[model samples]
Target chain A: MDEARSAVRAARRSDLHALTDLRLHFLGEAAHADARLRLMPDARDRTEHALPVWMGQADRVLLVGLDPAHDPQGPGADNAAPVAYAMGLLGAVPPVLAAQHVGEILEVHVDPAHRGKGLGDALVAILGEALIGRGAQVLRAAVPSTHEFARARLERAGFAPLQLELERSLDAG
Target chain B: MAATFASWLQDPARLVVVAEEGGRMVVGFAAGVVLQGNGWQIPARLGRITDAYVARPRRRLGIARRLAGRLLDLLYEKGVGTVRLAAAVQNEGALAFWQSMGWSDLETVLERAVPVEGRDPEA
Candidate 1:
């Protein structure tokens, strides 16, 4: 557990390739957890292209967890790849009350092999700090209603339920 | 309010409809935006009614309904395949209002305060 916690850190520009793979993995996990989720064929390509832009943004935060014991073989090896990642964006809400800035957790995922450790909590803590540093007064996340595990994690991490998104098909009528 | 209205007016993906009395005084307004569904189970373009307001004096006159109807029509004309709106759970009047207009409950939004560091959690 300690090893896994230590492996987590803020994602850097050099981690783009690993970040892209982790994003695809996260999408697959999301789909498997919910039958309603359908992965776009170009999701991988889009993630690869968008990661750099999102990472470069001042209002965005991305954190990654690496395999604690990963040792590079020589060259072109799958060394130091991220085992998990969490991305968030800072946004401004309509001027209400004393708080205006809100931080939204856009996506978070941990590799199957890295489950059961405290890596997820570590990532959330780091990201929360980053968001607070950026002047966010509140943190928000929209977890899939079907993803109970993810929802549980967020609840345990000091996030409270925000809104229920109900949807119906217009084509039904 | 001015900046928000201006931005919404400028966004091509959004539609703003206003009900005016005597062609000058604004009585009510409805605003909506076209949201592309996340390629999951929801693949169609969605029209989300972000805000709708009707003057209290204009209540029961169907001005709000007319504004919403026109907004929906414009959204559908723009190729939106679905429409949705959210109302506070405690506001039974608003709920009934939307229901009467053919909008059904979708999801309830829950909000939680972020606990400040070093603060008492129970507080």
Candidate 2:
């Protein structure tokens, strides 16, 4: 609600620690909601390892939402931290018919306390801009079918159902 | 497309099966590839059926089913324990086909186009 005290910007390498925390939080929530959800038990370690490479890549987009009221000194300050974040990757779309690029929103998370303040919307919008700048024609996101809240949030952001992915356990046979 | 097909045909991890009528005219084809699953869960080899098509006239002749079965056999020979595929929500025929073949519903992939123009001149 305090527009003057909140800001959203590209995440820096130093924000890796905060981003990792948020990623873990998101994964925890997802796994709690769905026992069938597949998540890395070592998600924190993987995020820490992958953030640097993602930060340095031009085709990758990472944005963090900051509450200046927490720490105005800037992102690396001891008290400064990201309350929400979004990450996306631009990928070539199989070069079928016409060469095209697609942006996949790999992760988007907003701290529970930070929800309802439109931070999630701002994060996705900025990420979409970044992807569009890099020649992405379409944006894709995969939300767990059981997560109605997440699905509604994406729909509010203009996403629509594209395809249904079906899988079967071959071990049953 | 021909070049892409040729290249895939050369990849040992990829399986491409084609059904030909009269031993010359191609009637149907199926393609799949083997992939390694991420280590988060069970470490299993996965197979994905990327594309399958049978001529419209050749649809009910069992060409598509035969091609798909052969492709699955090849993927199994390559050690793939799981297989996955996607079907457009509007394609009832395709959905029914996969479902009848014993594939279970997994997840839906949603998409949206980023507004290319209008709104926020400054991003």
Clashing pairs in 2: none
Model 2 Cα interface RMS deviation (Å): 3.8
- lDDT by residue for model 2 (B41-67), tens: 323587899999998988888888899
> Residue A149 CA error for candidate 2 (Å)?
1.9
Q: By lDDT, who's the top model here?
A: 2
User: How accurate locally is residue B62 in candidate 2, as Cα lDDT from 0 to 100?
Assistant: 81
Task: Give the per-residue Cα lDDT of candidate 1 at A110.
Answer: 87
Model 2 chain A scores worst on lDDT over the 10 consecutive residues at A68-77
DockQ of each: 0.26, 0.50
Alpha-carbon lDDT, every model: 0.74, 0.78
TM-score of each: 0.74, 0.85
Task: For candidate 2, write residues A68-122 as lDDT tens digits.
Answer: 3454455555446788899999888766577667888877888998887777877
